[model samples]
Target: MWTINDFPAYGSLSGWSTKGYLACPNCNIDASSQSLRSKIGYMGARRYLPENHNWHRSKLFNGEIENRSKPVELSGEQILQQINLGTIDGKNKDTDKARLDLEDMQIRKELHLIRHANGSFQKPPALYTLSPAEQIGFYDFLQSVKYPDGYAANVSNCVTAKGGKLVGLKSHDCHLCSKTLRVTDLEKLQEQIILILCKLEKIFPPAFFDVMVHLAIHLPYEARLGGPVQYRWMYPIERMLSLLKGFVGNKARPEGSIAEAYISKECTSMNQLQNENSPKATDEMWSLANGPNALTNTCLGCICNGVQFHTIDRDNRRKCQNSGLVVKGDHEDQLIKFYGYLCKVWELTYLFGHRVVLFQCEWYNTGSSRTLRVEPHVTTVDIRSRWYKDDSFVFPSQVQHVFNVPDTKLRPNWRVVEKFQHRRIWDVPELDMPEFDEVLQDDENSTIVPTEPIDDVVVLRRDDIVPQIISMEVSQSNKRVQPEGVMDDAFICDDDDELTISGDDEEDEMENDFDTDTDLEF
Candidate 1:
């Protein structure tokens, strides 16, 4: 399974057409489109915005006030209606018909062609088109971006800068990004997502949505329906297919070739896998997985909280840095973060086959204001400043990974400390231990029923929405550029700025929707 934006696969799987004005599978029937002078454009994104946004009143967007609430696309029964109405053909709609529709609506008047007395129309230069210099600069910016080591696995090869334009610019991390933004919270993700899409609509041209951008609206719903993304993502399945395809030595009979190779590999590994992982030998498997605690289980690398941490000695010859660390400690009875460079590691044996991983580190001075400073954005630590006198060790469970970036050429001793989090890694929750003492008593779940109703639970709404405003400096001579931060007053549109929706009611709904085993408020 892959993203719904993959039109053909999506259409075949869902049995809905991804064509014409209603290309978005989610917004099947109600998806709006505008006829540009050249091609059709998805231009009704303002409908997703809050009813009273300042953007609605501005002439910048379609030259009309957006008075519609967010469209809720329910199902795909509309596809049948479209077919019966003779509108499901795969060709793009007539631009002249679209122009007539726009003319009748009396919106986006600037897109109208200049008509002469001789019954001839003259085309005007599109305001959306970027100049050569601006296009080059944009391409350069993308090409010059420095992504993390593994975060952009195929993005580099996918993007290309040539002839003052970008080639093959497609969604490399749409699914990854969708999961990251909405997976954090599913219930309220819909509102935030609508805002984000509306923000994009404000920045990008109508044509920018040709890539089925509206499909993003349904990601939260899909995530709620499907428990985990791994079950639907194409990475594992595609990789397996690639491996099987690579086994094809005989092109004429590829099926047989793949089958032979698969059988041989499965034969070699299946016995070992089944023998080692048998459920009847659970104790033996656990003993092997964790290893014995009697003699020692010294290690060069340790996996704690999904992050694979290596000892300083193991990384002596490697270029990757994993020795930098941060741990919480008590300083003047205040919980403060302590930054350090890992020196050594120890696996201490304990009773009942238990072991503890300890990190011996050389810490930087965090007590003094000058030695370490937390800026508005990042934390800067002076490496020369010493804290080895205070503390030397931290438990693996308490340690968090941190990377030191050289602050500047001027301050050679100072370093900017950025915390490292395992992005793609997921830690599986430990299985519940069986109660051998008696029939397991189902104790009261605090999360299912809290001791007290949370009165101050934060309810996300359009009134409190804060969107990140970005400034795009385009080099154009005659074009009148729109001012940046146009959306700075998005929902603060009118005199009645007070929220119409009750915060308490919204909070109660959110709290009830949120189910957990612990008494944690999200």
Candidate 2:
């Protein structure tokens, strides 16, 4: 039968529009109202994760979070509410206002610091500088992919020729000849590159391992266990969990904008490498921690009782010899012991996978708990009234299609909102001609000019491919097998095709704020 592809003319029975259904005015995918509405369950809803930035960040739920706190169970209605109005906390308008205020204050503070540090030393540049082309090339040489040799020496020599001599270094010195650079130059280069790299890595990260773990847990035993349903909410849920974890100090963003850029760039390579080099743990271990046993192998279990086991020795008991087998502990004690056993299993699974499960353990333990303060207005709401009433309520009937959307089924699109074309990339404000001319007039172009050879050398290079000016094309599939620039000394791929599932990578992205040792001068 030919089915109507358009949204059902009928009103939505569920709280929000489900996949395969056209977006309703009240749903996350409501395109017409997108600018006016806040997305509730969309994956890309978190571009404003940095509390300092103005992007409307929200406190979305990871199923696990709700699982831990009974009062915070997410229901369809709550999710829909978030979608319609952003977060209950000031919504999009409030976030935008906050962002503007923060940015203004930050800019003022930075200006104040700059004035304090170098107010006297700042020199008004002489009129008549290099052309615009020269300025662009110079900036590129210093900060772009192409690295220039003898750049500093050339710059210093040029400066000395124009004026009598630079007070610091003699011309004959290699450092003056551009053989070496000042600490400031090195620091600047590092900063630029790190920013670029982090931006890249953020595109992908460890939360992606959830699907892999789910597969590893059930794949070998039940081939059909990890099909559509398991993955329906997997990607969005994982991303939501990552943000939640971050709020709780389990994940972090260090080096600010620069680190974020680097992560986005390298995340794909990292994921592939980690997956290939993944380790293995015994099945007993896998079933303990994050698996079904997470129910019994939790902190509550440890504080209360462990696990339960069963045994029989009725024949030996009849003879009063207990020869055939010996049983120890009562039912309650056995249950607690069983719980402990489950925890170990989970620990083992975590060890085998390329992940780390943060748990409280006496030996080899490293985990901390801290208060996670959400926005004052961000209050918990129910996805469904029943979900709050009975945290364990399973609403399979509320099961909606989540994973099969176009671009969504793939790895790269897991955390992206494929529906919209991003405006930020193209919406940079145009440069005012008068302001540009004035800045260019007094700029010292010679110092920034790029005399370096323009080539693809700055990017990754393959062993087999020769660099050519016209084109630099490499097969995408082959590139995945061995990414360029990865050193021969790098960690080798494990022999096993399948690795035991651990949860470290997934958790790392959730740290509240990561510590960075970025050393950049400007």
Candidate 3:
């Protein structure tokens, strides 16, 4: 329902006067009078209309008077393009090139000045000149040139540090350190703006104190909306409109064409929902797992009955037998040894095939003084498990068992063990545990286990529990260690700390061209 009038050009709406002497939006410094002036002179000192009235001028100068005209008005884009690539007036080729070259050099210097003034980083060449929206977004002219206690620099630092982190509330807690820091930073920013305004009145021109500049003071309040500026910007609507423009195939009847295209797309989408043969629904269910344990088509392990197991090769079963593998134990820091082959089980469902693996390992109980030989058992384990030392053993390391090898239903169900390493504790001194205590109520009908007396510590045999350390051979050298107080005499020199200077002969020659003894005075 918006019209051209509702969305007026920002420049026109701001009552921006392209001609005549205009004060800077920030410092109220006349643009034409600035040390580094604009190529297109738009701002400078001038007499008031009443002071230069026709009657006053005629009376003072006897009819002879100075004449003035409105300055040429240029669009923001035109001004920026001239600043970046220099004036592109259609004129003599050689003169234009030389002028452009000089203007380009001056523009580069001006860019550096603006960058330092705003405390922003060096902009890329592509962004040397500001776009219309970018000019409004930056609003650089509204910022104070200086502030008390280097307030401008502090505000820049605070904004740079906290801006990116304030985009979402999902990861932030209201009472946490991050949230508190943002609040304090915002307060400091507001204080700096107020301080700057108080001082700006004394330094800048009257035009600098305009309402447009004052509007900048409320930016912090706007940012407190709990997300980045882009979230509330018009970019999404603009993008959607651009997309709709592409949908217009008929130029004469563009609106009708766009509507038809949009409705047709929606109808097609609705029709696709009822079509079971469509690939979209099936594709949604085939998504792969993410993170360190992401699943792949060539995955070596699978889960069955709430337990994970690894696939093994039947041909290499003999090679994997007695292979030393590190398996997690019941205790937090405990690791156990499991020696055997890994095997898999296949099952046929109504729609898809399923595969699971089993670890056929010999359990070596290390809790006793002697290496107690526990009965061998087959159980489901994580497929990621492998031999820690040598993998070349007698039994098959991995095997793929086919289900239709006649009757997987007749086979015994794989045993699932409890995973002790799943629960992790990450407590530290500064990051203390939560304040609240968890309440655990016992069920009246549930049976409780009886407490048992502690047993004596068992001294394990050296061969049974020897620490596994992989040792590397070291080469012997004749180099001797130096005494603590001794210094290397070879590196000592009289000019060790002195800096060396290199003379530029060309620069000296250029400087000699200018006569320093000249009596010229300003």
Q: What value does the lDDT take at residue 447 in candidate 2? A: 36
Off by over 4 Å in 1: 1-8, 37-40, 67-69, 76-87, 90-170, 174-184, 197-203, 238-300, 310-324, 341-356, 362-365, 371-386, 389-392, 402-522
The order of the candidates by lDDT, greatest first, is 1, 3, 2
For model 2, the stretches where C-alpha displacement exceeds 4 angstroms are 1-115, 119-335, 338-522
Tens digits of per-residue lDDT for model 2, 419-521: 1111121122346452422321222212322223222112221223222121222112211121122223422321122211211111111112232221110
Sum up the clashes in candidate 1. Answer: 0
Go through the candidates in order and give each one's C-alpha lDDT.
Answer: 0.51, 0.23, 0.29
TM-score of each: 0.53, 0.13, 0.22
lDDT of 3 by residue, 1-522 (tens): 011221124324444322222322221212322111111211211221234433223212111242433233455675666457632110111122222222332322221211233333332222122344444333322221111110112111111121121111111111111101144345455545544543332222222232334534544544443323332345446757977898999899999989999999989978765653435444434422211222323323333222233434431222111122334344336655443333332221212122222344433334442322233332333322333333232222232221101112222222122112110111111335532221111122222122333222222112222222213322222222222221233111111111111111111111111212211000
After superposing candidate 3 on the true structure, give the runs of residues whose Cα lies further than 4 Å from its correct spot.
Answer: 1-8, 14-185, 188-218, 221-228, 268-522
Residue 192: error of model 2 in Å? 38
TM-score of 2: 0.13
Would you give me the overall lDDT of model 1? 0.51
**Judged by lDDT, which candidate is best?**
1
In model 1, the worst 10-residue window by lDDT is 500-509
- Candidate 1, position 333, lDDT: 95
